[model samples]
Target: MSGEPEVHEEFEARLKTYEGRPAAETGVGRDPVNEPMIRHWCEAMGDTNPAYTGPDAIAPPTMLQAWTMAGLTGRPERAAAYDELLRLLDESGHHAVVATDCEQEYLRPLRPGDAITFDSVIESVSERKTTKLGTGYFVTTRTDVRAGGELAGTHRFRILKYAPARRPRPAPARRPGQPGERRPRPVVNRDNAGFWEGVTRHELLIQRCTDCHTLRFPWLPGCNSCGSAQWDTVAASGEGTVCSYVVMHYPPFPAFDPPYAVGLIELAEGVRIVSNVVGVPYDKVRIGMPVRLEFRRYDEELVLPVFRRYDEELVLPVFEGVPE
Candidate 1:
């Protein structure tokens, strides 16, 4: 991470030579197109399209890059040109890297049991560029993913490798497992102050667009349906169903238990809210399960909204049912 800033004039021309060079040659997929991975992807994306399921199931077209992804060991037969280019950038003090975006074009449908392979080329390397992140070049790679010797898709990926413009603010060391370590506080701005105030009184309030009367969640400043800035608050019934959920198991955070279920509850009013589902084991959390909202006090100053299952008595669901 430590490197002296070198003269940009010395290496800028060298960076241009990397354009149109091979990045990866004949990179093979770690796994063949299969049903289990497709099923998992569908479940997580909440994509219920029948084309992704049943007999004659073709992999989702949007999953073009997914089929060619490399594992931790990295791309098989990766060309040295890309490596040297990145090293040159690193040596020039552009050590931070982040993927910006990707564009995919599907040429053919990829079915299960299809073997995937790809070849990538350095599409372009921009000259010294300065952005909010810092000064560095934007490197783009174009990959042609193939199946059975036929082009199945084209994936264009872009990344920014740059030096940090400024150091990030230091965070206090946190021990989430130990008692009394506080979770980071939420930002209460002018636009969202009312929502937090409603939480204090244990009222789940949603914004209703004054123009179209459409209900919106998380207290948006303007209505998405009609683009109206005028809106009013509507008290939710707090009864809902689990539309989707995820079990967080890694990268521990303050005051949170790992492997916990975070549910997206579709409320009776038709809007959805995301909160922890506490009544059942994390693994037992199921889509379409009934849930009811409740306010929980984590500490004297922190009270959060969580949900409990309809049938399971693992956790009590008590809201006091105050009049809205």
Candidate 2:
């Protein structure tokens, strides 16, 4: 009764069957929501809100996923249906995987000593679609967390499993001895245009919520605390320490060289920004190493902010790339 078998139609039908299947059942948290973990998270994120501290402290709403993590040992209660679905995709040639995004909704505050548990389901599977990364189905999983048998929050995580598309970028046309292609410009919009504008004037600006006065970087339109949209700018002290860092060694882009250190700099003003850590060997870069701000010109047209250690001589030609 079937004509020539449809290629993707049959595969998609099989995927749809797995939707609503159990992903995890009654997954218990390894530890109760407590103060130490909250303190560590706040330190790493440079969050100084007093609401997260003191005897009356409550866990940050963003820590919803932390209490549910299974850690290095892996989750024991994970259902097989999710694994089987992923295996089905792997066998069908969509092998590479990337987490596209996630969202969380908090219903109530989590207090210390509160026991936590969660259950997850394969929420949805999208029909086949092509993207710049490649062609694949988007799989979404929804996890509901409970404290003392009461719903506390929900987390929705989405990922793309696909066979990567082959992309061949040709060399840019140039006269002899000219520099390589100029660096990828950071995407500037209404929310972040002010930050970039400060860079032009050799100043680093951090956003402060007018209501709660909590400082934040990478400039969001509204404060995560109190949801206040009113904000003001505070110029940074230019003194910072390398809170964390990673060295990029593979998958070189056109405007960047491999084996350079990128760091999360914690400024004296209690906010963090990401920038290239130059003037030192990549391996020599270490956490807690002090860094200071400096603006470097890559060419006549582009200039960017970078941090350098006090000991190393200034280096030229550091670059940052915008991912496709």
Candidate 3:
């Protein structure tokens, strides 16, 4: 038998030994189901369903795993076998891990004051396989959650512990006067074509429903409030404040610089728009800081509206924000 193939088979056999073993057992939720967590979850998700509020409020069904979270210190009941299995994969060069997907099934609703317990098992470990993210095996865990010893839900989570694939950098565009590399073009269809056109003319136009006199951003085909298809344009006052922002630093792309700030700006018109916040460092972008509109031309074919801090001196037009 070939030595390398024999080694591979032995490794696979070792991994299979962990399948169906307990990943976590006798895991008790740190907090009982309550309104404060429910309220926080609803607000973060922008969910306003009345069923989640008032005295009769039940926790969101998807919060099944939330109750079982180990937090920074992790759960005491977590088995060492699961950690050992992951260590083996990391030793085999599958050191990077990203959650691929999850599935949940709810059997009963959980209400305030319900104490939760869960047991998780290592459901399966796939044979070594190659993916766009590089070669790795899929690890799936299933957690059975219970309330007062009654089955409440099952959550299945899958992750890819992979070695990232190397990608060749795209060559710079050869055209004279063109930017080094082209940014991805915005998807402009009939619904949002006017928005792109307005950008080309150096205007940030918000859509207003002619029927109900409601203003909306991103050029929705119909009014969300009144369901009116008839709409007109209103020029943005070019003033806004950062409502929320994120600094991206992973899975680097060729057309972008890392550690950039992408802000959800609350416009003076009462609508919110997401664009890059420039002038200040990414880490310095704070909610409630004022920003002003600016148009940046990537190439002859691409022009986008971005926001700069209202306090910074205007710098020459450059690609400094998230792609629209």
Estimate TM-scores for all models: 0.51, 0.49, 0.50
lDDT of the candidates, in the order given = 0.83, 0.84, 0.85
C-alpha displacement of 96 in model 2, angstroms?
2.5
Question: Using TM-score as the measure, which candidate wins?
Answer: 1
Candidate 3, residues 112-225, lDDT tens digits: the string is: 999999999999999877888777789999999999889999999999987666433435643333455467789989999998888889999999999999999877899999
- Superposed by TM-score, candidate 2 places the C-alpha of residue 28 at a distance from the truth, in angstroms, of 0.7
Order of all candidates by TM-score, from best down to worst? 1, 3, 2
After superposition, the stretches of candidate 1 with alpha carbons farther than 4 Å from their true spots are 1-6, 174-324
Query: Of the candidates numbered 2 and 3, which has the greater lDDT value?
Result: 3
Supply candidate 1's per-residue lDDT for 93.
71
Off by over 4 Å in 2: 1-5, 166-324
